[model samples]
Target chain A: MHLSTSIWVWIAAFFTLAIFSFLYKDNPFYRFAESVFVGSSAAFAFLNLWFFDVKPKLWDPIAKGNILYVIIPLILSILMLTRFIPKIKWLSRWAIAFTVGMGAGLGITGMIQGYLVPQLKGTFLPLWVPGNLATTVNNWLLVFGTIFTITYFYFSKPIKGKFGVAAKIGIIFIMVAFGASFGYTIMARVSLLIGRVYFLLHTWLGMV
Target chain B: MKREIPLLITFIAGFLIVVALFIPHPPFNKIEETFNSWYIIVAGFTFILGIDSLILHNWEKIRRRSEGWPFALTVILSFFITLIWGIVSGVRTGHIFSTNSTFRNYFYLYIYVPLQATMFAILSFFIASAAYRAFRARTLNATLLLLTASIVMLGRVPLGNVALIPVISIAVLMLLWVLVDELKYVTSPTQRLIYIGIAVVAVVAAFPITKFLYHNLSPVTDWIMNVPQMAAKRGLFIGLALGGIAVSLRIILGIEQSYMS
Candidate 1:
C-alpha cells in the first residue's frame, strides 16, 4: 500500500490524468496540459540539438580555433536563418536545396539497397523442397500471392476475367493484412492504457 | 537564377550520392557522412525558425486576448522555463547550475513523457469508437474485413486464443475453400494457363499441402501473416520503391518545384 512520495511522480500522474480527461471532453486542464507538453517537447528538442549536435560538432571546434572546415557549414546554417527575413527568404532556398538534394540522393540509394533488394529477394523462394513440405507449400503460396498482388496494382492493362480474379485475391490479402496491422495497433494502444492505469493505481493511489 | 541554381544543386548532390554508392573511394565514400554533418548544422538552425513561429503565434494570441489566452501564456511560460533551465543548467555534469539540478529533469520526466504517452493512449478510445462504426458489414468486402479484423483481434490476446482457435480455424478453412473454388472457374485462357502451371507444379511436388493447415489460432494468424500479409506488403514495397525513385528523379531533374516553394 506504499504510495509514491516523489513530487515529480505526483506531477506526472496529474498530467497523465489531465490528458486522459480529454476522453470525456476537452477542458481547461487538458488544454493546459497540452500546451505544457508542446512547449516542453520543443524546448527539449532544441536543447538536445544545441548541446549534443551544434555545440559539440559545429560550435566547439570553431571556438577552439579549428575554423577551416566548419566555415561552409556555418555559412549554410546562417543562410537557413534567412528564412525569417522576408526580403532574403530566397537565399534560404540554397540551404533547403542542399538538404533536399542530399536527402533525395541518400533516400534513393538506401531504398534500393535496403527495401527494394531485400523485398525482391524475399519473393524469390524455392517452391519445392525435399523434406519440408509445409514450408514448400507456403513458399508457393507466397510466390503466387506476390504475383497476383503485384498484378492487382498494374495499371497499364485493364484487369478483366482471370486478372480480375487474381486482383480479387490480392484485395483479400491486402484487407487481411490491414486487419492484422489494425489488431497490432490496438494491442499497442491498450499497452499504453495499461501503463497509465498502473501509474494511477500503483503510483497515485497506492493500490497495486 | 533562383530556381536554376537550386535545381543544379539538387542534380549535383543527387548524382554525387548515387555515384558514391558504387564507388568505394575516399572522398566519394565519405560524401554521405560529410553531407549529413552539414545537414545537421543546418537542421539545428531550422529549429530556431520553429521557435520563432511558436513565439510569434502565442504572442499574437496574447495581444489579441483571444479565448483561452491564459493557456497561451502557459505555453510561453513553459517554453521559456524549459529553455532557460536547460541553457542555465548546461548539458554535461557540472556547470554554473549544479550537476544535480532537478529542474530540467523534472519538467522533462513529469510533464513531457506522461503527456506524450497519455496523448497516444487517448487514441485507443477514439479507435475503439471508430472501429465500432466502421466494422459494420454492408457488403461482401466489408463482411470479410470485419471477420478478418475480429479473428486477428481475438487471436492476438493471450486468453482470447484459447477460446477463438476453433473459430479462426473454421474461418481459415472457409477462406481456403473460397480461394480454391475461385481458381477453378477461370474463363480466361491466360488465367487457365497460370492455374494449370500451378497445378502441374503441385502435382509434381506430390505433397499433402492440406497438412500444413493448422487448427489453432496462433498458427492460423501465422499463416495469414506469412502468406497473404507478406505478399501484400512486398507488393506495396515494390510499388513504393518505384514511386520513390520516380519522385527522386523528378526532384533531381528540377521538375518537382514544390519543395522550393
Candidate 2:
C-alpha cells in the first residue's frame, strides 16, 4: 500500500482517529474534534449563505444596475436581523411570515402532487395475476399494509373494536418498517467504518 | 399591527403560490420562481442569526469557563479561521471553491469531510450497543423486530454464510435460554414438559433452519423488503403527506400562529 504523503491527508487521518476515540470514551481529543466540526460546519454555512444566496441574489442584481428589482428582498433580509434588537424584533416577523407561507404552500402542494397521488396510484395494483403467485401475494400485502398503516395513524376515537384489529396489524407493519430501517442504517454505518479503516491502513500506514 | 401584517403577508404569499398552480400565465407563471428567489436571498440572511446565536452561546460559555470552555474557544477559533479563509480565498480567486484554494483543499476536503464522516461512522458501535440493549427477545414483538433487522443486515454483506453460522448458533442458544427461563413460570409438570419439549425441538430444528437460511437469506431479505416493508413504507408516505397538508393548511389559514411568535 502506498502511503499518502500529503499534509492534508495526515490532517484528515488525525481527525478520523480523533473521532474514533469516542468509541473508547468521551475524551478531550474527541471533544476538540467535535468542536472543530461544529465550528467548521457553521463557517461552511456562513460561506455558503454568502456565496450562494446573499451575494448572487441580492448583491449581483444591485451590482448589475438592477437594484430596484431585488430591493424588497434585501430590505426584508435586513429586517430579519432586527431580532437582535428586542424592541424592533417584531419587524422580523414579516420575513418569517413569508418563509412560513412558502413552506405551507409547498407542503400542501408537495403532499398532494408528490406523495398522495403517486402512492394511491401505486396501491391500486391488480389483486390477481395469472400464474404469478408471488406478485399477487405482494400486491395484496401492499394494498392491505397501506390501509392498515394509514388507519393506525389516523383516528379521533378510542383504539378498540374492528378498527383496533386493523390498527394492531398497522402497528406490526410499522414495527417491521422501523426494524428494516434500523438494520439498513447499521449496514450503512458498517460500510463507513470499513471505508475509514481502509483509509487508516492503506492511506495512513501503508499497511493495507 | 405586528401580528396582523405578518399574517397578511403569509396569507398573500400562500395564496399567490396556490393561484400560480391553477393559472399559469405571464405574471402568475413567473411568480413562484420570483418568490422562491426572494425567499432564498432573504433566507440567507437568517443564517447570520443562527451563527450569531451559536457564537454568543459559546462566547458565554468561554467567558464563564463553563465545563468545556477550552473546547468552546476551539469552536470559536475554528469558525473564524474557516470563515476568514473562505472569504479571503474567494477574494483572491474569484470563488472560495476555486481549484487550488486552501479553503477547498485544506479545510473543506480534509478537515470538514473527515470530521463529519468519522463522527457519523462512529455510530456503528453505538447502534450495535443500542441493539444489544434493546433486543432481548423477551416479547414476540421485540423478537420479530430483532429478527427482521438481523436478516436485513446479514443479507447485505458478503461471506455472510461464514458469519450467519455464529449468528444462528447465538439465536439457537437464546431460544433455549428463553425456554429455560419460562420453566421458572411453570405452574405444573405439564408446563415444564412443554417447555422441555420445545427446547428439544428447537435444538433438533436449528441445523435445517440454519442451512435453509444460509442458502436463501438474500431472497428472504428481498421478499421482506419488497412486500411487507414496502407496503408499510408506502402507508407511512401517504400518512405523512396527508398530515403535512393538514398542518400546511392550518398555517396558511392563520389557524396556526406559532411561526408568528
Candidate 3:
C-alpha cells in the first residue's frame, strides 16, 4: 500500500509519544529526542545566519568592491571572534563596546516614544464630552488607575491619606489584571494539551 | 577602560537616538538606520560564539567520559555536517540563502519539522498534569479557577456543555452583563464627553486611540490586548531588554568574564 496522509500522520504520532514520554520520567528516548532538537537548532541557526543574514549584508558587498564598507565591520567581527582566543580575549572589548553602545542608544530612544510618552498620553483622554456616559466613567476610572499605578511604582515618595488609599486600590486593579492574564495563559496551554490528546486518540488509536 | 568606553558610547548613542526621533530630520534618521545595520552585523557574530561554546561544552563532556558522551558526539557531528552543507549551498550569494537541493529538503522535512511538532506535542501531558493540580476545588479561588478552566475546555469541543457546563454559564452571564451595562453606558451621552477629550488629546499627540491600534485583530480582540492587558506586557519587555543590555555590556567590556572561564 502507498504511504498516504494518514500513514504520515502515524509517523508523527509515534514521535509525539516518544517526546511525551518525558512527562512520565526521563529516559533514553527523551534524551535522544532532546539531543536531536538541540543539534538541529544549533546547525540551523549557524547556517541561516551565514547564508541569509551575513553573506548578503557583508560578504557579498565586500566581494563587489564595496571594500571600504566592509573594513570597520570586518575589524569588529574579528574583534568579536577574539573571545575564542586564549591570550587576546581583551581585544574583543572594542567590538563589545560598540554593540552595547548602539543597543542602549536604540533602546532609550525607542522607550520614550514607543512606550513612555504614548502610555502617559493614553491615560488622560477627555471625559468632558456632551453625549458619552460610559466614556465618562471609563475615562475617570482610567485616569484614577493611571495615577494610582504610577504612585505604586514610584517608591521614592511616601504615600499617605486619601490619595494613598486610591493608590492601594490601583494596586488591586493591577493585580486583578495580572491574575486574569495568568488565567488566559493557562487556558491557552490547556487548549494545546486538548489538541494533542485529540490527535493521539483519533489518529493513533483510531478510536474516534 | 574597555568597560567604561563602551558604557559611555551606549549612554551617548542612546541619548542621540531618542533626540533623533523628535528632530524630524532625514540625516538623523539615516544615521539611526546605519547604526541599526551595524547592530545586525554584530549580532551575526553571536552565532560563532554559540557554536564555539557548544563544541567546547560537548568536547569537555566527552573528554571527561560523561554518561551522554555519544549524544555530545552526535551534536558536534551534526554541527560540522550542517556547516559543510550550508557552505556548499551558497549559490545565491547576494541574498538570503535558498537551496534547490533534495538533501536540504529532506533534512528539513525529516529532521527539523518533526522535532518542532514533537516539541509542541510534549507540552500536552505537562498541561494535563498542571491542570489536574491547578483545577482542584479546594477553596473559592480554586472554584473560580475550575470554573474558568472547564468553560474554556468545553468551548473547544463539540459537546461543550457536557465537557464544561458550569464554567460556560458563568462566562455567558459575565459577557452578557458587560455588554448590557458597561457597553451600553459607553455609547450613551455622559460617556460622549469622555470620548471628545480622548480624541482631542490623541489627535494632538499624533497617536490615535483607534480601536485595534497595533495588532490588526477583531475589535473585541484588539480591546482585550490594548487596554489593561498591555501594561504588564510592556513592563515585562522593558525589564527583559534592559537586563539583556546590562548583561551584554558587562560581558563585552570584559568585566563579566565568567562565560569565558
1 versus 2: better TM-score goes to: 2
Model 2 segments more than 4 A misplaced: A1-3, B23-27, B64-67, B180-184, B187-211
Q: Candidate 3 — number of clashing residue pairs?
A: 20
DockQ of each: 0.57, 0.73, 0.30
What's the best-to-worst order under TM-score?
Answer: 2, 1, 3
Best by TM-score: 2
Cα distance off (Å), candidate 3, residue B99: 6.3
Best of the two (1, 3) by lDDT? 1
Backbone clash count for every predicted candidate, in the order shown: 0, 0, 20
Off by over 4 Å in 3: A1-14, A156-164, A190-208, B8-12, B24-27, B89-99, B135-165, B168-261
Please write out the lDDT profile of model 2 over residues A1-208, one tens digit for every residue. 6778988899999999999998888899999999999988889887988888877887888999999999889888888889788899999999989888988887777777777888799889999999999889888899999899888887766789999999989888888888898789888888888888888898788896
Q: Each candidate: what lDDT?
A: 0.77, 0.86, 0.61
Residues A57-153 of candidate 3: C-alpha lDDT, one tens digit per residue: 8888988999797677777778888988869887776677667666555665566567666766776588675698866765765666555655566
Mind giving the per-residue lDDT tens digits that candidate 2 earns over B34-152?
88888878767666666778999999999999999999999999999999999999878777898978788778888888898888888888877877685677677777787788888
Residue lDDT tens for model 1, B1-261: 888887888888888888888885889879867877777777676566667788789889999999888888988888888888878777554432344665546765676778998998888888889887766656676766676666677666676655554654564555555546768788888886776666565444423332332236566877777787788778877887888988987887788889888
Question: For model 1, what is the alpha-carbon lDDT of residue B231?
Answer: 82
